[model samples]
Target: MIDRRHFLQSAAALGAAAFVPLALAQPYPSRPVRIIVPASPGTAVDITTRFVAEALSRSLKTPVVVDNRAGAGGLIGTDAVAKVAGDGYTLLFAGVPHLTTRWFTDNPVTFDPVKDFVPIARVSSSALGIVVKAESPHKTLGDLIAAMKRKPGEITFSSGGAGSTSHLCSVMLNDLTRTRARHIPYKGNGPAVTDVIAGQVDFTCQGAPSVVPMIKAGKLRGLAVTSAGRWGEIPDVPTTAQAGVADYLVASWIGALAPVSTPAPVVERLSEELVRIAQSPEFKAFCASQSMYVDIADRRQFLGQLPKEDAHWKRIAQLSKES
Candidate 1:
């Protein structure tokens, strides 16, 4: 029933609509894509970034490389990538602190955590554990809390660095228990944890992936986990809330992000690939080996949670000062 001219016009519109997705996928990354890991080369972020990059490289049919830029508690690397061309080829392997750390600092950073970037996907999240040297006097988390309560502001703890997630964890612990603890900032968790093992600092919080082995070996004593529920990775470990401090939980998650101006279709494609990457059996095993859990969500959910994280940043910053 359609005339030739009308059929041609309809076909033209349908073809144009189809061309958008086609163009979006048009052999993207005709060259190498750089995934920026904004931390030391051997840290959890670095290790997982490498794994995801390898899987993504094979899936995307492009050689995706990881660039480790470490400094200023990950700010240096974030800033570096923020200025790169908005093409999909350049992306950041960002940690959760991308939202939290800024409020704690007085210094003005050049990077806009939200506006300057687009979230591709939330790859994974892990809990932190408060640990001390195996030979310490604080036999239990309750004892540590009692000691702090009795001498408010006297107990001391160490963190990976100023404004690091470890530091925020210490701040959160102080707020929850209504105690005061002195903070000692170090270069990274490895160094701060070294001091804990050496009894240089009283205690500190570290990610489960790195601390579980030490706890198992009896080198470190885990007092409380920073997640809401107990993790099977350390069956004997209790969550901070379960350890008598109500409503205590902190997590560190890594995600892929691109410049905000990148086209939505491009970002959607990237997110789909990320979800696939997370769903792969190999990636699941990889996460289990590290005791990491995927927080995998599409863009809308990620964007919705950004505001909640922003509010949490303010609370932690205020608590850091109070502690």
Candidate 2:
């Protein structure tokens, strides 16, 4: 029913309407982006998150700053990010602790870790090592395990806190070996390692970087690392499998995440930039220097793997409760 002129006008209007959304939409990362690190400064999470932020600042063409929100085992900052707008302005630099936080805390978590955040990219990870005081009578992992088997709950282990990766490492070890060890939760990794050095506890499954120096200084002895293979820094140390228990690998990983329901376009942009940063040579060099590795997972893989990891931790929590 339309005339030629009317038809032409309608076509032009349709073209303009299609262009409007694209023109009005602000380009992603128009402003500074904040990375919320839910741990104290100088912690592994904080250090790696800062590296990722610096690299993102370069690639995103905007200032990417790290905001350390240390409390509740990284729950405070992580919860803040979860509750914020999903505009990609705020993000969380999450670690393994983020997964087990709910299990550790007495208060209900304010946000669902899996459902409340969009996985962006994995940053870096380190291997945990079993370390005892240099003067401990046990010389090898087998000797320690034999003693644990003989004593069962008598062999005590310290961790950064309950439900930390360090604690979980010992749990996984115990689970594999079918042995029980007493858990002594400390305020932080530093104190836990300090106590171990003083022989206040038996041993600790702590990150290599935290205990490597002590190992080098003859303060602590490295028995086994929790990686599939020997870590570069301590090549002399055997892996958990090589040490005794086979098929045991528990890596301490950190990654990036944004609030759930973030725009797909923004999430894509952030994920792309972060993956690039994680894979860059500069970052790899930094990780190597720190005895870490660039373990990257893209958005799809990260999200897909979350459910499995969540379930795994949940089972561990349930088992811990049962025992």
**Residue-by-residue lDDT tens digits, candidate 1, 1-323:** 77999999999999999999988676666788899888887677888899999988998889999999887787878888889878888899977667766665566798889878888888788888999899999988999999888877677899877888889988888887788889998877888888889998889998876688888899999998988777677778888877888888888888888888777877888888888998888888887877777778777777777667768776787778765
lDDT of each: 0.83, 0.86
Candidate 2 residue lDDT tens string, 142-184: 9899999999899999988877888888888888889889999
For each candidate in turn, the TM-score is 0.89, 0.90
- Candidate 1, residue 113: Cα displacement in angstroms equals 0.7
Residue 217 displacement (Å), model 2:
2.1
RMSD value for candidate 1? 6.6
Give candidate 2 regions above 4 Å deviation.
1-24
